[model samples]
Target: PDCEKNVKTLVDGFAAEGSPIVLVRHDSGDPESPLHPDRAGNAFKPALDGVEPALVVPKHVHSAFHGEVDLHAWLRREEIGEILVCGIQTNRCCETTARLGGDLGYDVGFVIDATHTFDEPAQNGRDALGADLLAQATATNLHGHFANVTTTAEVLGAIPAAG
Candidate 1:
């Protein structure tokens, strides 16, 4: 619920500070999928409606680094050394991006609260993992290793004020 709001806060804060903002959109190959290019879910949320990003990356894979647009190359060309990652599916796309960003040598900040995920059914009769648990796991997995797991407030506070 708070994911979208937190993302908007981060977007506004970064924009105000003149930071390069990159938005990644997932384009599912299946036409019937909600995230398909022709579907309404392909559009950004209402909170992000008027936000303009420096780049919009259309991705078919979970990792933003492996998207249609070469995110790593763009960052290198722009001389951007650090990145803040936030998006839907905390355990999937968000986590994947953070992990790959770290491997690619970018200073990565995984905004934990700005991401969300759904409960996943376990295999082999194992217990289902709740969304909250999955999100926490993602934070634990990324923090200190792949990225610095942080909150929306922390990220906003780090952004320099608009001069």
Candidate 2:
């Protein structure tokens, strides 16, 4: 989805600023299927080129905090004041992590456009919404509720480096 391409903008911004960037990769090993971290499914779509990741986190569940405890420790050690969160499955991992980040006292910024998610059936695929509707609902639920849901350009512009 767009999360892969959208993150490139963040990488570029951080690169220009001479700051460090951390990459958290998810590998659930599929509750049904194993070997979840395939090359195609490893990183977000449209992966950025020429960006050296400072950290690589491997996670299983939807909550990054649960899989990668070191991320919390690392963020604390590095004095990470704010978290710019965007990733796949808006209702699952991204949403869970954003909530965790807020609970951890980080200034959470949700890049609404930078994240991508698919439609999910509710109650065992019985009642559910489409992807677009789900995305919109997620946005509405997140905006002013958990974090500041914004766009990629707006988030980049808010940074000092983008100036």
Candidate 3:
């Protein structure tokens, strides 16, 4: 998708600007665990296109803020006030992380199309996870519920020098 490519470009642009790119990796090892068993490390999708990760936050829960996400502390250490939150499983980590980011006083932003997920079999993708549903749900809830969800192009255009 264009969004994935654009997001990679954005990630690279940030690197060129010397901005620290924070990556939140979710682990799905134990079904009992939030993102455990089948959900871990699935945070990144093919859209990332092999882009190197700057920081990998191994989160066992839905929220990256949990289990050593240390996002808040990391933000402080980097003197960052705004976060460009992008990753997989939109309805889960993306939503959770955005809310937590807001609570911690960082300006949270979402690259809606850059992230994705598979909805549970409950949604009927022939027993497949309906990521479409999850992504939509996340967009609905996060748009005004916690953070501002925007597209990669719009976000990149919003960057001062990118303009």
Candidate 4:
């Protein structure tokens, strides 16, 4: 819910600037998976209730670039040179997509505060990390290399001033 506020703000600003908002959703393609398109978990969260995206892409993979929805092609077709990514599971899909976009020659802006993730258990019996720490780690990895880790306000401020 907290991250949603930032995401909503960013989306609204982009909409005001006539920037296309591409909503990339996960669909595991397995009926048993909660992320299956037919499952309730696949529905857009309440935070996005009134937001209308320019495009809604359903993907079967973590990286939107490798999804069945052909997000890369769409971006190319639309002449999109940059992407602002914010969503659930910050360390997984959001991070992967940002990295892929950068490798593909697109400038990727990863809104750290606008992305969220669940607490992750320690892999080797160490202390588990909280969501906030995970989010920060993701931002640290993405910054300077894959994407420009940014804030919603910074991105909004970069939009050209309305005439």
**Candidate topping TM-score:** 1
Write the residue-wise lDDT of candidate 3 on 1-163 in tens digits: 4556766878877766767777776676666664553654455656555666667777768787785667677768878899877766577777888988877777888888777666477655566646777787788887876788898888878777676
Candidate 1 per-residue lDDT, tens place, 7-46, comes to: 9989888888888889999999999999999999998889
Per-residue error (Å), model 3, residue 4: 3.6
Q: What is the TM-score ranking, best to worst?
A: 1, 4, 2, 3
- Model 4 residue-pair collision total: 0
Q: Estimate each model's TM-score.
A: 0.95, 0.86, 0.76, 0.91
* Model 4, residue pairs in steric clash: none
Better of 3 and 4 by lDDT: 4
- lDDT for predicted candidate 4 compared with the true structure: 0.86
> Candidate 2 local accuracy as lDDT?
0.76
lDDT by residue (tens digit), candidate 2, 38-108? 54656544566667867767888877777665788888888887887787778777888888887888888
Model 3 poorest 10 in a row by lDDT:
34-43
Better of 2 and 3 by lDDT: 2
Residues 74-111, candidate 4, lDDT per residue (tens digit)? Answer: 99999999998898889999999999999998999998
Report the candidate with higher TM-score, 1 versus 4.
1
